[model samples]
Target: MSTIIHASAAPKFPLPFSHAVRAGDLVYVAGQVGVDPQTLEPIGGIKEQTEQCIRNIEVILQEAGLTLDHIVKVTTHLARVEDQPEYNEVYAQMIKQPYPARITVFSGLGPYLIEMEVLAYAPSIRGE
Candidate 1:
């Protein structure tokens, strides 16, 4: 059975989807943008946006009783290829050693400069 997860620390945009889904030992976090929690507005340049995206993902993980260290995989999308260097810098700083396997793509991402989704795992605690 799977359970939906939502983070109160993140923006509530009245979207139709849950922020993440937990199934057994794994949690699938949906793609997150750089929208500010207070204003619900997309943040500044790539660096700032990338930071916010990670922060948003962190909140989702928190709701699942997990942390960044639990992430096993990641998928990143970049609206502009030119911002790759800045994105990489921010990403590296946010996620520590023994990094999760990741795939990054440069594509049009609407109004956001960067976005990321993650898969994390932890031992099942439903019965305990």
Candidate 2:
């Protein structure tokens, strides 16, 4: 069976989408931007946006009773390829050893400098 997970800390955009959805042991996080959940505005520049995006992902993971350590893969989309190094600096600090498989994609999907999505896997929880 599949379950949908929503993060209370995520901004309510009145959009028809869940923050992340879980199926069995896997969780797929939607694309995350730099917007602050409360304000719904882009956080900062490329670096700050990258940081915020990661932080947002972490929050969603926590809501699912998971952690960054449980993430199996990450897909990043950038507005400009030139910002990769800056994005990497912040990305490296978020995950630890045996890092998750990741791919950096260049696209114009969001208004911020960085956008990210994640996939996580873990044992079933009590209410999951």
Candidate 3:
């Protein structure tokens, strides 16, 4: 069976979509932009945005009783490919060693500089 997940602390999605969905042993998180939860406004530049995006994902994962350590894969969209170096610096600081498999590409993200989605492995954890 699958379950939809929501995080009260995460930014409200402008569109209709759950924060994440748990299916079997995996939790697939929706794409997260660098927006403040209360304001739902995109944050600063790529580095700051990257940090917020991961923080947003962390909140969603927390709702599922999971953490960044549980993530097995990641897909990111960057409005500018040139922002990669700064983005990678912040990512490395937050995601620890044995980093999740990741792929990043340049894409038009409207007003946002970065957006990220993650897949986590959680064979034992359950959502409330």
Candidate 4:
């Protein structure tokens, strides 16, 4: 009745976790950081890190047979409050109109500027 989708292009941070898990019609993505998939190093500042984080989310969505448009909400984590403006600019670039509900909190990641976790929803063909 349900399945789990693992993102192949996801960054391997020496941890045991799937990118997203699909149960019923909802897909839950784990907290994603701005690290290169191959290099495994943290990306640039807030702006650049935000871009990379979104990209990683996109990859996970694709693997789960979804897209950014399917996401219902997003939770962002930042190391610095001053990065809010820059993070907004980068975030808006990837997501389109009728944006998903969002919440951004401040957390200090190891040697990182920002981290993000997204909650995405998929349509239920069975219910409707």
Error in Å for residue 43 of model 2: 1.1
> Per-residue lDDT tens digits of candidate 4, residues 13-85?
7788777888888999988888887787888788778888889888998998888888788898889889999
Of 2 and 4, the candidate ahead on lDDT is: 2
Segments of candidate 1 deviating more than 4 angstroms: 124-128
Worst 10 residues of 4 by lDDT: 119-128
Model 2 lDDT per residue over 1-128, tens place = 88888899976677898999999889999988988989989987888888888888889999989988888888989999899998888888877767788999899865788788999988732233
TM-score of each: 0.92, 0.91, 0.94, 0.91
Best first by TM-score, ranked: 3, 1, 2, 4
Give the total clashing residue pairs for model 3. Answer: 0
lDDT of 3 by residue, 1-128 (tens): 99999999999866999999999989999999998888989888888888999999999999999988888899999999899999999999999677888999999999999999999999632231
- Candidate 1 lDDT, 40-118, residue by residue in tens: 8999999999999999999989988998888889999999989999999998999987788999998888899988999
* Cα error, candidate 4, residue 106 (Å): 0.7
lDDT of 2 at 41: 92
**What local lDDT does model 1 show for residue 118?**
92
Pick the lDDT winner: 3
The TM-score, computed over Cα atoms with residue i paired to residue i, of candidate 4 is 0.91
Q: Positional deviation of 67 in candidate 2, in angstroms?
A: 0.6
